[model samples]
Target chain A: MKISCVTTFLMCGNFDNTLAHNLFYVNMETPTQFISRIISNDRISEGFFELSLSWDPRAPVPMPGQFMTVRVGSLAVPLLRRPFAFAGFDADSSSAAIIYQKRGAGTELLAAARPGDELDVIGPLGTPFVIDTDQSKHVIIAGGIGLGPMLFLSSALKSRNIPARFIFGCRNKSLVPDTKMFTDADPQICTDDGSAGFRGTVADYINTNVSLDNSTTIYACGPSPMLTSVNKIAQSSGARCQVSLEAVMACGVGACMGCAVPVVGGGYARVCKEGPVFDGGEVLWERM
Target chain B: MGANVDLSVRIGNGTLANPVGVASGTFGYGGEYEGLVDFSDIGAIYTKAVTLEPRGGNAPPRLVETPSGILNSIGLANVGVEKFISDKLPYLRTLPCAVVVNVAGASEDEYRRVVERLESGCLDSVDTNGSGIFGYEVNVSCPNVHHGGLAFGTDPAQVERLTSSLRELTKRPLIIKLTPNVTDIAVVAKAAEAGGADAVSLINTLVGMVIDVKTRKPVLGAKTGGLSGPAVRPVGVALTCKARRAVSIPIIGMGGISCADDALQYILAGASAVQIGTANFVNPKTAGLVSSGIREYCIGNGISSLKEICGVAVD
Candidate 1:
């Protein structure tokens, strides 16, 4: 379960010296079709569920911010795999977890899944967030189920002895994830109803309290609108920012070119390939 | 019963070691799925469509999932044939299986030019010991493009002219991929044969459109897209039967072939070989699975060769 950093960098060919660049270069090891066994599928809130699967130690460990395209059912009803970001992993137990809210037919089927069920998965696909070590302060932001990757990123950052603060924003107190889940960092929890922590949105909380400077690096994952606001704040304040994007993908690989997001420059970048994680400046927010 | 089944069969002048091959566009240049799939187990790899000039393809939302199927409006996005030859062909030449370049163009002359370049460089002289491409699969059935795709494929005259011209360009095997959008695929299949094509493959995606009720617009970037998957398998089988009765040449059957049973239906319908398309998107290892499954099926049925069952349903 211990991922050898030397082996990881060697496997990922283009490893530059900088920690941020090295994170981006983490080779998405050739994807394999793994028949993973579901260890637990627990409903945490009204609609959200935290599902964990026993992992094969041989399979490449998915880095924080990367995702897996999971097949919901044995039958081809949905036909396409639903992509989910890594929420957490227990190397000692050889299990990984994903947090999701029941939304469509795919998630509805996933909600019906129970422990001891076998699920087909292809991953650890897509790009991971680049953690800039030079930045003195790191801020992790999550919106709703976007907390999945943020929690995973928080743990990874902790392993590097880097300090990070978590800011979570949801609709109300009932929607917030268990505070015990984020024991490493005291989260600045915010709810729209003012029933839990801060009264405004996570962006509003950051705008009011957090100070962004050249030494600040912000990592955010959430709804597109929330990401747009955070991206704007990062750009205006001269702080480095990386955001994880979401899209409906047919093939998690680049062949289908289905999950494309327009970048700041001109052409489209495949979210399943070039990113699910991208620099705030690289993305064309309005175009998305 | 350990029956020694010969999955290998002849297509055009070339021979495939097995009947299962990955379809064009599904398998990208044979390099994308390298470590994920064992190339030695596959019969051939048909690369994504290559045109005379590089094409950017359609805008976002190029693909959407339907019930047991998928609609794609990729617009045949590919690196130009020149770049394909320079950048992709070298890696393809190293693969253990046969390689078939899927070529597309805006016009017949454009098709001829691409084939001429491929022949002079990649396909012309095959070192008996060295690895090289087996043939060319002419893609005239792409529904996403505006130019020579379905436009040239639907018309029998255009199919004949395009096929005949490309046939004259290279000694390598030429397989004309037919469009199901035509009124009668049999007529187009016969047209390809008349043009001296070595073989024909069908059915390309059926033209379909999905409307987003809330937005009141089509879901795909291209207003319409080609539909493929199990939904199109019956249509593909029926058309393959019709084309088999109409033409004497070999037929490559495709459309919604996800498992060995689906592939067996195509062989029984008259396909000498089968290609796995949209299923590749759903399962990257489908081709390998189908290959082993075919062998398992042949052994279970006590059939010694695939040719025994091919076209059995048609006769």
Candidate 2:
């Protein structure tokens, strides 16, 4: 009788690491694809998830700033799925849209996803920007796609009746999405080219318009360079700022540790574990 | 009737449910995956290494991906012992299996401080399923961010001293995690045994590096970090074999173990148990598959238990 058991074996009669406790894990094979219906794909803002989608409710809800590795091709050239930040989820519509730029291999595939084409959604993974209410009023600052997390956070704030403002900066007005989503706070937009909204950088706009009272807190996500600039602005302004950092993440979970940001103290922190969102004061901006 | 396999294996004063377990750092305080993974299914869940004071960890650029592996300089970022006990330990008590605390001390006194706190029986409380801590792993192999982690693990006397000092604290079984960056891994393994360690885990992480050719600077915050993943499995198995021959104590093997075939190699080479570290990144389900694979191998081979095959291939 052939019998095999996943049992601990003795090595030369010596025992291995002592058993500590019983651990239970779910075998949810994160499937690479899903069946869903697209309700609407509206270009809400320069970068927004205002589009409605109805898909497998069984599909996990996308976390804020959490990404999806979507398959973009019917061919083998772009074999791997491109990762994009999940903008938001509409339970009523049952659909989600990811905001992204036309970058390399997988991202180009994302831009090609037509209506009715089923998507292979892989995630909702990665440590999300943790919003703490006790800290202060939420001030969301975005540079380009950095605006993705703010939309969802704004909806959350609106539902909670929390005071929040959206500061979005892009290369120019053409790159900035429409203003319907920002109807809440009269979003302050800045384009480097002075093509639309406020002329100059977002940090410049924050310096000109926003005042840093003791109750002010900032949440920012965009280019690392922009985050660095925001980090300095928030520091000088003396506002508690949390920035959503983007790194090349392989396994978005804490495992890969590929997405690590420098901590201000002395050691390194796993962006996926310690935080995708970290207090600006705690990060070593100069080094990054 | 085929050979009766006995999965029950005894080392020091304790017995583990199986040989497959989680390594330190990779599996945070155990509860991080509690909702997703059954803490009891694994033979042991090694908590993050706790040092004397709370660690803030290294600056960014801490992790970089290599060909098939990863290099991380996380600088052992962890909430100090106080928060660990207050926040994380309560969850450990609720686990149905044993909780192995990985201890890392900047100084000898700090190690004692951590153990002293746990000795009060607070950590051994009844779990949600009513169970207590299974054991403690002295993670001496963790690379130091201050002086570099390889210094201590490479020195035999340091290994012995670190182990012996902690051995006097509790009667609980102790396993020393060993670094593979040294010239000879067996030397340190023997030193651990001499220091009264109940067991030793081999191949913590090979000191490695990856540099982006586009930029002159190296990847990873520290420039070099511990390499782990499927790329290192062969080396891990070989080291386990060498450590097994050099010492009489039990050996916990880990490195690039991703599948059942890889784990069996470690068992055949004399590792009593194995820890799945880097693979946890590829798939959270890898551990379960490995566990299931182990059982399947035993069943198909007509082996009744895991113990029957332990070190069966040793020459």
Candidate 3:
């Protein structure tokens, strides 16, 4: 009933897809918050770091495209939790990892973290990526720091015995994550400077080289302009596209009403709750 | 277990089971933290401010983390009065904690109308026997909205009239949330009490600005937002004490209260109760921790009731 009003108010008398609404908003399972010990903290590349933590056995294992918020400090400054998408998850070991860039104060604090350090984490949060069983092919795209969830999605597709084309974009070879970290799902690297596997942007290569059709599904996580371009490409080829978003988040829960992004419709949706992953068609590219 | 220590606080006709509460805006309508935070330990839940109509809120980048706080310009985004009764109120009714409806509006009549609807419409469904809507926290202090937020709070006369008008509407506690952005918050507190307000909560966020160097643009879509968390704790404590000095009504204090020790600063300075604000985003268990910690402090110090410490730290 609460969700109905929230959904009704957010719906601008223009929604035609209840399936998408249910998949993204309704029937949400509550998230769990717990203290997890850091298993490993490593700088896997220049400007990129990966911190792995033990997952709470009682909570549901975070699926591909889902994110978590880590309490960087116990005090007031750096007051809000830092949100990170799950880059990798090992079910048997009951562990999860986030590949982050050491850019701000939050990640800087996170970089100093060591093995066995207790970290407060809330997770298996937001809407997870929905994989279709009948799609003939999948295309996974990740850009720099956005590699976190895309990396997880690539592995998810592989486990289901699905074939996919993986492309990861970076400014240069140094900014790219180590190939060893992505052993589970091999990705074709595309650097702006042509210092890696393929030259030019990920969208550039896909527009020129990759063939898309109704049978193909495109999954992406990247900067806004790149996503806008990818969505255009997918739309032109009649391929369904899902783009994972990144935003400065405060509660990471639905409460704060921060981390809002405009959808294709008139109203705004909480990226922390309604999604980090939104269908490309539902996105307002011009607004971004 | 310090069960003998009386943690409850009386505000007008309503009584808070304990003194620790999650501030409005930070706790949503109490549904967001259901599974995450233990609600049984919470004394009250001040829900997100409800306006006359649904608000879309500010655009993206509504929040930013500062040194020890968060700057937010959520623009009082909410589900409105109708949805509040139909959607939010039911879930809040089920919570063990006291529910305080935080009301905000663009005009005086809007505020009155919302209060009127809530009091009249919720007569039958409210679990007053249990812990239902015990009171209304008037949010004239919200800095994010353009009209009827800071505009109404900054003026003492406006606050007084607003308080009295709403005061005449219901028998429940009426807490006027004071904004620290004002030059003299005590003046407003005195007005609220003079207008027959049951209690007043202080202090709302201080106006702050953050600029991005690269883009040469403001971090928030709204040029400025309200600052909460530890950054404003000292300001909140100081203003809260000033209001305490001027008014006899119970004062509910909040700023960057992350734990009980911080809450004690307000309590000692004269606050009867305290609300956990930005810290809720950091740790949802802060209410439980703060309430328990306050209990221990009371027991250790041989303090039987909150009256023993409140107003001890005089100006």
| CA lDDT of each prediction against the hidden true structure | 0.85, 0.68, 0.86
Best by TM-score: 3
Model 3 Cα lDDT, one tens digit per residue, A190-240:
999999878999999998889999999999998998899999999999999
TM-score of each: 0.94, 0.74, 0.94
Tens digits of per-residue lDDT for model 3, B204-267 = 9999999999999999999899988888899988988898899999999999898899999999
lDDT (tens digit, per residue) of candidate 2 on A137-197: 7788888877766776666555556678888888987787764555554677889999988
* Candidate 1: regions farther than 4 A off: A1-3, A6-25, A182-185, A193-195, B123-130
- DockQ-based class of model 1: medium
Write the candidate numbers in order of decreasing TM-score. Answer: 3, 1, 2
Better of 1 and 2 by lDDT: 1
User: Which residue segments of model 3 deviate by more than 4 Å?
Assistant: A1-27, B1-3, B125-130
lDDT of 3 at A71: 89
RMSD of 1: 2.9
| Clashing residue pairs in candidate 3 (N, C-alpha, C atoms within 3 angstroms) | A76-B68, A77-B67, A77-B68, B229-B256
Number of the predicted model whose lDDT against the real structure is largest = 3
